[model samples]
Target: MTAQNLLVELFVEELPPKALKKLGDAFASVLADQLKAQGLAPDEAVVTAYASPRRLAAHVTGVLARAEDKAVSQKLMPVSVGLDASGQPTSALLKRLGALGTDASAVAGLKRAPDGKAEALFYESVAPGAALAAGLQKALDEALAKLPIPKVMSYQLETDCELPGWTSVNFVRPAHGLVALHGSTVVPVKALGLASGNTTHGHRFEAAVSPVVLKDADSYAVTLQGDGAVIASFAERKAEIARQLAAAAAKVGGGCQPIEDDALLEEVTALVERPNVLICEFEAQFLGVPQECLILTMKANQKYFPLLDAAGKLTNKFLVVSNISPSDASAVIGGNERVVRPRLADAKFFFDQDRKKTLASRVEGLGKVVYHNKLGTQGERTERVRAIARAIGQQLGGDVLAKSADTAAQLAKTDLLTDMVGEFPELQGIMGGYYARHDGLTEDIAFAIEDHYKPRFAGDELPRNLTGVVVALADKLETLVGMFGIGNLPTGDKDPFALRRHALGIIRMLVERNLDVPLGSLLSTAIDDGFGDRFDADVQAQTHTSVATFLFERFAGTLQEQGFSAPQVSSIRFDTSVVLTDVPKRLQAVRTFAALPEAPALAAANKRIGNILKKSEGDVSATVNESALVEQAEKDLFAAMQTTVPAANAKFEAGDYTASLQALAALRAPVDAFFDGVMVNADDPALKANRLGLLKQLHDAMNRVADLSRLAT
Candidate 1:
């Protein structure tokens, strides 16, 4: 089969900036996949995706003009039913053959095959290949149907003829043109009420020509760039924008660079076809406000990339990605600066107004705002958090730390009433910190208030200070306990309150900071002392169990994600007294122990011992009577424990878990011999009890760091 590269493009109005990249990729991949499925393109065909503000396109190499014919064998029916005893075709066989465009004369060519217990007749034939025109039409329809459109717009297209009727069309944007070319020949295909052609329009304002005519599949991008004044490839255009942003920032001197935000870069890439990076500036007075507020407003509201100095502080200058390049760029820069000045002024006004009333004065207003209907107002939640924070701080530090935590927690949610935070809700903790410093509060409290929401998402940094860690822990714990208490738990992916994030935050604090606090004890304090009169006694106990289970499940998943084997994580039993800091060490010890040569035998023996203990008639104690040991194997096992148990226990007590587990390697021989020679279920009751007790002691010693039986498999 002769093959040639293919090109397809859909030109439309400006697409949704965030969804353009995904839509473009989906369009190209789906089109190529459908072509491959229809045998019109080879499996190893190279697919290149091109996207701009007004276009989605793809170029696939090695696309055949028509798919190759394929040999196919299809099962017809049972041989006995298809043929009579006289060796002639039955009416049913004739009818089935007729449906396949065959007749009774073709019966002799059919082959018989056994399909299970019964023999069935099979028909073999060569299926004709699909033409590129039909294959591409199917691919185009499937690609358009599978696009991840954020929203669809329905528009009416006027009939080209004098029908005087409007045809309704639905698409992400209004499609103005489509181009499909197999090499240099135009492929006849249609989409969104438009016929495919060899030409496409681009650069709504700066096109070098009216219609960019593509000469071939290979020339589409170059031709579009030269004649249309547009960059067709999304990745190439984004790289160009980034390069220009860097150049523009460097031109402003002072070691300035555009703030690094890939999402902002992608959005800007989707909003422009030519991508002219221009440096714009606002008044220096606006820099008095926190850079987070200014940078956020510029990026979020205006899609501008703000420049930051060497110290990572926001400068008055910012970069804008304009769609058109003019001989004199001053007008565009001035227009953007004028448009952003009012936004920056609003942020400044909010900041100045919020500072007039200190965070302390705003604390009382939180009562009016409901946090959750079942969990009371933000005022009550703040009180609970303060109580929890004080308790955790006292345990971590002394009275001074506790007082600081309480003060920080008291003012943490006061930012909810701030004008700056009200305008930008994402700046809640951030604005609180600024206000705290302005109120003459200590830096410790200010940082604590600001960082109480630290580690909001995965890979985010933890709280910077110990005070912040304490408040963050308390705040997360209070939310977890309160939500679990009210039976508002996360189901599937619908975590409306971000309880999963809050749980992970608590885990990170305890483990990363090595807080040395028992997770159970913290939950107990939060439940018993923090939320006063909120949950009843029964509800409190149930909530503790539910929350603990949920946290342990999340912790286990986290350990697995960190590259620990499932059995290793499973061995470290998560319980009320399990300290989060100790889990990783224990898991490492389990991993080390699992690598020993005697590990498998010991693990298997430990598993057998567990099964034996579970099946024993009465309660089996860890205490073994040495005098009752009759068998030689049992006596040897008991002697081995006398020296090994104390040494292992000492290492365990000293926190040398790996050494502790390694000590048990000496007993593997004795354990194997005991299982081989000893009869655990003796006819004599006292003898049986002694053997069971002996096995119970061995199991306890082996599982101190982790349950060794989990490593058996």
Candidate 2:
């Protein structure tokens, strides 16, 4: 196969950078799949995509001009199945052969079935070779015609574009022009009725006002910077942003690092055809306002990256990235500065106005903010969070810092009403901490008040502070139990309350913090305490059960993430009644133990013992009758268990699950030996009863460590 490079670009006015990336890759995958489906694959294909706000370009290398021909799979009736009583082909089979362009005279012998089924099989498919490049061209034209250009619009003039008169492109921004090329040749194709060509526009500012006729793909990129205004790559744009921020901060001697806002960087990166970083600052008086207010103002209102000093203090300066190397750089900077001053002033006003009222006073305002339409107001929810935190704290003992939780809960959402948080919603927790400290709250309480929202996204930092961990648990606990009580569980895409996040947060707290709150009992207490005066006993019991199942899912996921095999974790968690909050840690121990060579043999022995003991399920416990015990193996097994039982209990009491499992492994040898040497189902009634009793003891003892028989290595 000869090699060729395919270059295609859709020039747009200005696209959402994020959306452009999705579309670029989407178009690449679509084209690749289409090519393969048509059997028109090249020796190797690669699509290099680039997009700025102005354009989306995907260049496919080693392009095939056509798709491979598809061999039709005809479910033809075999001659054996098709023949009538006279042994001649039936009229229906002849009609089918005629429809498929096949002649019965050239038919292969009837395929026969050697198996039991009577229905005969037919001939498999084979493809005849055809022009691969022609197939590719046809498929390419069809795909481009149907290419998903969402948010497309039409203009009156139609130059053979896909739509009548004018058409919309598959983007929020307008698809101004497109360039398509196959190696050095222009692959003449049309979609939306527009013909494919190598003509492109340079940077909307720098290049010719009209479309550019590019000689080739490589020069197409380089020429855009020199002639056109477009800077086509996100990587180049982001590097420029970083450099500018560093340079700007250095000039002020502010000693700051860029905040590294991924979302802001992406959005700003799109806005420029060519990116240049510029440093700017606001009035020093504006610095008196909350740092969050100034930061959000610049980033949200002006697309600026806020700089922070060495101690993580917010500097008044910001780094603004621009797309165009504008003729009037000063005017662009001045206009942005002027636009953001009023936003900062509004934030300061909200912050000052909020400080006048106490957090406790703001609690009343929470009543109006709905936690869920079904779960009542934020005020009610806060009460439950505080109550559950205290209850869980009691179970966890000193590490919970219950008093700190109570204080934190009081001030947690109070910041929701503050000017800082009102203007910058992301600063809710941070603002709370600042206000708490300003109000002379204790350090633990203030930290908890802010840190309760930790582990915001997957792989984000967890709350390491003791007070914060407790309060965060309390917050999630309340959300989970309260939402379940009101019947608003997450399903499909309908997590109106974000219960998944709350559950995930709870898992992180338990697994990472190693808090030993008896999960089952803690949930029960939350249920009882949270709805002590409201729900009936029956409703409370059901709600408690539901919440337990929810927590179990969270624990299982957390355990699996920590490297426990899913099967082992699931089998251990099969029993819903056993609530393990620190399940991930325990499962990790179990997995480590299970990985040892001894585990499989031990598991087998336990399963053997379980099968024997299951027969004695409803029977009365066999009180040992030394006179009735006839087999030496049975006596030895009983004696072994009696000694192992006390020691196993001690290890379990110490919460050393690993030691407990190891001690339980001791039973494996005796139990297996006993089964080999002794006949558990003996003819003699007295002997049979004694053997079963020993097996029961074996099952009961090992179960204390874990239901290990169900676990798989």
Candidate 3:
């Protein structure tokens, strides 16, 4: 049994709950990796991470007492400097002579030095130790100290240093102290100048000013409870929150679900030192605004959860979680209600004012604002989006969004001119949607008005409506084309325009929406639209290819994120580099193709085919004359290819790349036979031409699927 454990906590003013939730998981992953790197194995374990607005804490259990012992060895040179009769280290023999401690004879055999400066070195040393605790602690400290915090504070200790805090130890919040223990004994952590000590504290509001001394990790929770805090583990927090939320909901009315505000729940969990649930309500008139509007106002403005009634209607009721237990609970409820109503009222007013103007009536406003310094006005962008959206809509077999998309694109950014959207830039599409609907535009246009910014994050909702997808793609393409046209392309980590995210957003839209338009055509048209007269055809091709390659790499990354390895994705995702709509199928092909144990052999044969074809220098037109065949293997391989061609093309055309590769897989046997039995060095040039032609034909056939020869085993 191991008696070691690690407990870590970082104090900050207040952390957002979403970030706080991922922090614990990320920390555990990195910590576990560090532990394994130190060669330590622990038994049953527990790591509890809790976050309050003010602090983030973690307690790890079942840690080992020390890192496993390790051996360190230093290599000694086997040879002395190979010196010539001149007594100098020979340039040619220097590498052969090991560093120092080389052979005495080898040194003596070298040309003797007058000063005898050429002596062999002493041998190397080896050491072994019981535990690498120092190394482990150092690594742990480095990782913890560098843990990324989105925001930080000012420090008095290290003024010049970038870390935020008043103390010399710059931390995200403040590193008031640390407590490192191994089986109830302080381990004396002096790392990063924040030494481990005999004491720690409970939730700031709960145990206020009290020190907590825990015997071990298992008892840490007990100590927290005694000090009025809940150990903030996701499992524990979720279970408790769910239980309390359900019980609270049951009392009000049966079948009430805790509003599905995981983000809200997470934040509240961290905001409270002790977890408690309460139900409150505001005036129901606020519900007159869109439910989404109300929710965002509550979430972004008030940090409250908007509960839903039994019939799934937005209720005026909300759930407030307070950290401190005040004497009069209704006073707290009244206070929160007081804070939220004004924000909601402002939102309602914006909704009312925005609806007063027809969306089409405001289209002229788009031309007044500039989207980019060089890329013309927002009206120009809208024109480009309209053109592209119409194209995408046509492909989706809908003329509805084709018109609505064009309309939405024309007016999407017009909302930027509105006072409401000007005040809250993040509300561009949202405000547009409300105003468009108010203007009595079709629901399709109204939906597209808001849906253009979709898939804002990974796993975020995508545009489900056809018109929305059209405008979304149009908007993204305009951004990509316009940015690339103006030479504002992303380089390294510096993307001033967020072009990468915009490109990724476009890809996710294509993949999730299953839009089937050829990415090449779309980009080509986009390039033509943006730089029709500005650049020569050569320049356009270069730009198009660059944009295509960028999109392809991002698409490949998308595949990789979905559990595909680089090699597997690279092989199939290579030249098939069309649009994201094609990735799922291509990824499927890569997986199926790689699954064949014979892939290596097939790859080898394909390489030969490519090399042979290249060496033939575009002479595939040379016909294979049966009589010109000098060896049966050459004749047989030629015959096999003739049979494989039609089937390969058919299967490939049917999107059965898996079956196509399978058909090609059959070539392994005949390909081996042909290579083994045929010698292309026949006296007859016709036979040579015939053989080369056959190889060229086979190579061209495979290239249609992908450049398999580029794959690594």
Candidate 4:
């Protein structure tokens, strides 16, 4: 009945930096969740997670020492089997009672209840609740088993005789100690062959005390920070590091700031217990290399944040987050600077050596590099992209654009053969742009080489110029059409080739750029020209539809994330012939039209017409027969359509989709009247066919911008 806070800690060797945060979160949440499920912790209990390089811990408040006992009802065998016809206890009843720790004397206490079609006997009793110690042990076991460890290590425990022991244990790292406490009392739990205790070792070198003793669950963080020379909370440590980084950057002046990278910040936080940010500098000469090369080298190789000036240019100085703080920080700064010199030097070397060879010369080497076993070498893929780019460029512009796009696509992938790109694959297209300038190539070609891989991930910027756009479109299409042709479509969550990203990139280019090129035409060009004879004839024939569907699905998902409702997207997406560039205009028009007072009635009428047309046997004509229209409602609707259709069609042709859809709002009254008074399925076949034809014309006019029926619900 009494409640107390709980603390748990697992001390081990250094954990994987990238996985430490996830492991700590999982450990705390799972342990707390298990306690709540077992009734050992209330729903209002607060849980705090702590993670460092050497430990994973949690502090939970308002945990019950033992869960409350509860009454339970358990079903027993049928009454017929438990007792004879006369209602006397049978041997089976006695055996069942005995198994339940009772005897024949308790048989009379059993109750009979109807279960299904038969009467069944039931036993009722009180079940004892779980104690904190046993519950914590179970929770601990479950948490450890569920950790998202990147790799597991196996080690043996030492024995008293100092001989190698045979008790092997597997964990993310070798476990050395464990601490579990309820209030101030040590909980009797064991894990990884270690008993629970109140003391834990802290920072390897800077701890003010050898072992930090926790007084209570609430005091764990304070004690660790004061005596252990460590910040226990992962979030707190990251924040402290960020604060120090900002302060340090401010001290540098000139509006200089440390480069912002969340992942790098988290990784550094996981690598230290006590963070101390110090400034370090490299020679100004190293800045001659592309700042991307220098910054990446510092972050990836040294885990440092390169400082940037007001103009967003990387400076020679950088910030280092060290685990130790000393009275004088000069030695740490000097040592880090010394260590980073070779990394920057190596990047400079790669950059210098790479520029010696032109991208055009590197083209021959791509022939030897395999792109995919099924897709042939990079040389062949580049040729495909070049052909596609040229075709797209020709369609969008004249011979000038086509020539630029072809040249850019031909040289785009050649950077993969460069030393800089080989060492840093993230800089593939980036290095190509730099090398193009060094080779005295035109700016358009150089930019196209770099921007061809634009919008590589979500939120990334698209190609900056027309040549870049043409090449990027060509590059992505080549991948999508080729892969789809090979039957390598993405299945649920398993996109090994990142075809989903490629498709989204294509969609973004088409929709964002508002390119006039048709989706089907682009696919056809990429297949028939880019990958001629590379795939089976049947696969080639189906590639356009399959790839277009995949791209449209990605587009629909994008729209949903942008706050468009599913039905709104569905209305436009249902038409495969709908131009990708025109989708936004059409969706905007639909949204605008839906706000009109007539929208609801017109949508419902359209739905009715759609259902009637679907069930009809023969093809319905769009031309209405005025002579066959006997009802005034039908005649008025037909007259309205004739007048409205011309105006809507003109606006639609002028690309004023919003205006086009808004023009049809006048028909809502006549549409409602026609549906209310007219019987579309008449007794006479000619009259019925003519009425159906009238509705068909109305449906076509209403849906020019979007399928209005989708808004009915």
Best by lDDT: 1
Indicate whether candidate 1 or candidate 3 has the larger lDDT.
Answer: 1
Task: Report the lDDT tens digits of candidate 4 across residue range 1-713.
Answer: 77999999999999999999999999999999999999999999999999999999999989988899978777878999989989998898788888889887777888889999799988888889999999999999999998888998899876535675668888999988899989999999989888899999889999999789989887999999999998999999999999999999999999999999999999999999999999999999999999999999899989999999999999999999999999999999999999999998999999999988888998988899999889999999999999999999999898999999999999999999988888899998999999999999999999999999988999999998999999999999999998888788888979988899988998898889988877888888888889877876787878878988888888999988987888888889543466788988888898899899999998998999999999999789877778989999999999998889899999999999999999999998998899889999999999999999998888888888889899998
Query: Could you arrange the candidates by lDDT from highest to lowest?
Result: 1, 4, 2, 3
- TM-score between candidate 1 and the true structure: 0.98
- Give candidate 4's TM-score: 0.96
- The C-alpha lDDT values of all candidates are 0.93, 0.70, 0.68, 0.91
The residue-by-residue lDDT of candidate 3 on 1-713, one tens digit each, is: 35466665544455656567666566555655565555443544565565555555566665665654554433222224444577555653554445434544454444322333444322333333224356446646765755666666555554335776554555566556565555566655554446666566776666744776666545655676675464546557666766777777777774665578676777666666566667887788888887767777787767777778777877788777666566678887788888888988887888778777777777777788787877777877777777777776666767764676677778777787776776567787887888887777878888888878886766778876878877887778778877776678888879887788888888887777776767787787667754576567886777788778888888878888889887667665333236567668766776777678777887888887777766654446646677777677787777788788779889989988778877887787888888888875456777777777777677777766667786645
Give the TM-score of each candidate: 0.98, 0.88, 0.78, 0.96
C-alpha root-mean-square deviation, each candidate: 1.4, 3.7, 7.2, 2.0
Estimate, for each residue in 1-713, the C-alpha lDDT of model 1 and write its tens digit. 88999999999998998999999999999999999999999899999999998999999999999999999999998999999999898999999999999998889999998999799999999999999999999999999999999998899999778778888999999999999999999999999999999999978889888888889998999999999999999999999999999999889999999999999999999999999999999999999999999999999999999999999999999999999999999999999999999999999999999889999998899899999998889999999999999999999998999999999999999999988888999999999999999999999999999999989999999988999999999999998998888888899979998999999999998999999989899999899778758788899989999999999999999999999999889999889999999999999999998999999999999999999999987788888899999999999999999999899999999999999999999999999999899999999998999889999999999988999899998
- Candidate 2 lDDT tens digits, 217-286: 6666776766676666666766776677777778767568877788887777767777777767778788
Residue 394 shift from truth in candidate 1, angstroms: 2.8
Q: Candidate 3: minimum summed lDDT over ten consecutive residues — where? A: 121-130
Q: For each predicted model, how many residue pairs clash, with residues at least 3 apart or on different chains?
A: 0, 32, 8, 0
